[model samples]
Target: MSKANRTLKKIKHQGGRIVPHLILITYMVIALFPILLILINSFKNRASIFNSPFSLPNAETFSLVGFETVFGRADFERYFLNSSIVTLASLLFTLLIGAAAAYALTEYKFKGSTFLSIYMAIGIMIPIRLGTVGILQLMVRFGLVNQLLSLILVYVAMNLPMTIFILSNFFQQVPVELKSAARLDGASEYQIFGLVIPLVRPALGAIGIFTMIPIWNDLWFPLILAPGTKTATITLGVQQFLGQFVSDWNAVLASLTMAMVPILILYLFFSKQMVRSITAGAIK
Candidate 1:
């Protein structure tokens, strides 16, 4: 509490910020700088791009050729929508089924509970791509190939493990007394899920994110299961666009920049919820 001691402590804290700030600033540059480069270059002419790839857009260099070509060649807005629909539907189905299964695993004690839980965990480490040949044939048998529904179904199955793992851990942290009391008050299991699940929504927000990123970013399943130009997700569409216009620097950069926009917007919007939800029940 002495004045000299307080001054020393403040100095130490001030010095501590330097390393962390340096690290943060370094990483931010590494992450954002490239995207910024692509975005600015997208607005620049072919000659200006080589002249100053990193320079700010100005009257001398700015152009919209990339944007023009991208818009002209493909239905980017539709591709964006396809990504959204598949991501959203897969997220919904994964969380619903995963949460329900997690609740059952955590809330009920039974003979094969441990075995069943272990069985579900097996999917986590396994890459479903290994089964592509069989999956393709099976889809053909069901006439589901080339459909967005096929992609949605595969994504749900793919993301189920982590979702169940997350929700189950959170469910276990919900006090046993709460569930018993809800039951005594005549709440059915479905009623309990309806009433109680909302309380865990911050956790769900975290789990929803964990499920969403892969589905949204995925290229393999979309390539294999639903490669139709009509139903292509943004990732695949952008890939196809880039391949077709490989020589068009402006269009290529534009497509990359366009693809980055929705994800960046989403991360900015839900970031706090995502972090909090993941760490919500850690101490308990």
Candidate 2:
């Protein structure tokens, strides 16, 4: 609390902002450096990629042969559809069920509510793959193995816990007065939820992004539950292709870049919503 010490502290605080950018610059390079390398080399022929690793590709040396080969070898269209179908479907169910559960946990006071919340939340930390022994057995018994439905069901169950926890946290932050007032005006429980969840649509946006990303990127459930050659997801397909064509640098890089593009596009488009959602629920 001395004046000289206070001034020194102020200088330290002032320096902190500038200091972070150094770290940021370093981390950014660390993060995007590989991506930058991949993108630059992707356009080059193999010899140029190896010879001039850091140089950007130029028109003279650039080629699209890798992409052509990847497209030529696989049913790329089917793989894309399989991934989209599974990711979209799983995301839809996770959001719907998770939101409803989160709302109930926050809005209602009932017996066993805490226990039920805990029970559902166990999935957040425990990988559902542990239960695959049973799940696969059941799937086999039900004849669901190698089916898209199996992937969807496993993903939904795996993702539900965290989604519910996030939505519930946000639901609790919603002004209780809003719900009471809605009820005062004759809103039913269903109507209250419908009206109120939208108010926190920002949180839902965050939840949707969070839920969708993992399912889209997941290789395990798709590999285990539905690993037929014909039904491979984009992630699984790309990985398989890389293994099969390890020496085909062009095809390998193209597949990686292709997989990276969709996620990058989604994040760019939704970054505002994602950033807002993260900040909105943060406790000061």
Candidate 3:
């Protein structure tokens, strides 16, 4: 090819790559804007929050009153602990059971396996919230009402279907030779499953972040199942600042800002793996 034609082709290739990155950056900015606003306003006084909602905290506007109120009026530490416990515990159980189930369905040949897979997939289609009444009754009967365990159990059940679906697809993509090699090396079934899990780390990261966000931010389940002060998740605990006639915007914003910390950490931790997974899928 001529130098001019070669240069044109190179430019075209670079533009193709740049365009997607531009789109992604635009989307990221759009998504993070609200969170940015919350964090900025959380540091400002109430008057400044209302007067210049989008502006950053300045010398005159900056105040710690919101943080003060939040810490003073509520046991935010306990709420944070409760939410962390429930969210992490739910993710742990969901991943374990879902991964095991997916491995069984994909790797094993058994009776009713197809039917069982279909039955599990049904959970993905039907919103778990639709069965709230029944779940509440079951929890009540089990004497788990107002308990963090109730939230953990419910969240695990809620997230399992999607987890299984995603993990099963990833598991299917695992090279047969890898598993065969493990078997040839005298690896037991459980050991082979362990070997497969690390290969699907990206999928696990994606599932962990996906499953965690809802469970952490969920107010409905926390409100219904574990509304007690001692068991309240951060999302529900923040509701205390919202009153019938008035709301403490400062404390509310501060609490929300603080509540977002774990999510940011999780995203930062798992973002690389998720990007790798997406890029890998796109390449294929």
Candidate 4:
């Protein structure tokens, strides 16, 4: 090849690599900007927060009054515990049942299997909030109103459709020979399903993060079915700081900042798997 042609090709290759990284960096900055703003202002006094919302906290403006108020006026510990319980429980059941259902629909050729899959997919298209009235009534009939279990059940149901949809695609991609080998080794159906779970860990991580975020951040279901102070999730608990006429900006920001901690931790924990999934999809 001519030197000029080779040089042009090298530049194109380098540009292809550099462009994606630059775009990713830009996207991250855009996404994190609001969270950063909230964190900075959460440490500032209320007046300073309003006066300089985007500025970093300085010695003059910095105060822990917001944090203090958040902890003082609310059962922060209980709210955190309730949210943890509901979110984790919902994720656990959603992944387990969704994985099982996906495996069956993909591996087994049973009657009505196609219809069942379609029925579940329909949930993904329709917003769960549209059935709020019916769900609330069902909760009331079951005497599960104002209970954490209600939130768990509702979240699991809400997330299951998408979970099944994603996991089904991944499960279908599992090599048939692997399952046949497991069978030859006398692995029961349950054992074979268990064996496939690790192979799809990336998909699980992606779905877990996607599913947990909505549940953790949800306020509508909690408000309708489990609004009791003892059962309030962090999102619902944060509402105490928001008043019609006199809102505590400092406390509200502080509470929001604190509420972000769990989601951030989970994202960090599952980030590797998510990256692997995304990279694999890109390669394919």
- What C-alpha lDDT values do all the predictions have? 0.87, 0.86, 0.88, 0.88
Q: 197, model 4: CA deviation in Å?
A: 1.8
lDDT of 4: 0.88
| Full ranking by TM-score | 1, 2, 4, 3
Which residue pairs come into collision in candidate 1?
none
Error of 2 at 68 (Å): 0.8
Strongest candidate by TM-score: 1
Q: Poorest 10 consecutive residues of model 4 by lDDT?
A: 238-247
| Stretches of candidate 3 exceeding 4 Å from the true structure | 1-34, 50-55, 278-284
Q: Between the candidate structures 1 and 3, which one is better when assessed by TM-score?
A: 1
Candidate 1 vs candidate 3, lDDT winner: 3
Give the lowest summed-lDDT range of ten residues in model 1.
275-284
- Per-residue lDDT tens digits for candidate 1, residues 1-284, read 99999999999999897889999999999988888888888888888888888788899888898889999999898898999999999889988898899989998899999999999998889988898898899899999988899998898888888788777877877877887899999999998887768867877777788778888889998999899988999999998989999988888988888888879998999888877765664644
Q: Compose the digit string of candidate 2's lDDT tens values, residues 1-284.
A: 99999999999998998899989999999999998788777778888888888998788779888889988997778888999999899989988888998889878979999999999989999988889789989999999988899989888888889988888877877897988898899999999989987876777777878878888888988888888978899889888889999998888877888888888988999999888777776851
Task: Report RMSD (Å) for each prediction in the order shown.
Answer: 3.0, 3.9, 4.5, 4.2
What is candidate 3's CA lDDT for residue 3? 100
Off by over 4 Å in 4: 1-34, 50-55, 265-272, 275-284
Decide which is better by TM-score, 1 or 4: 1
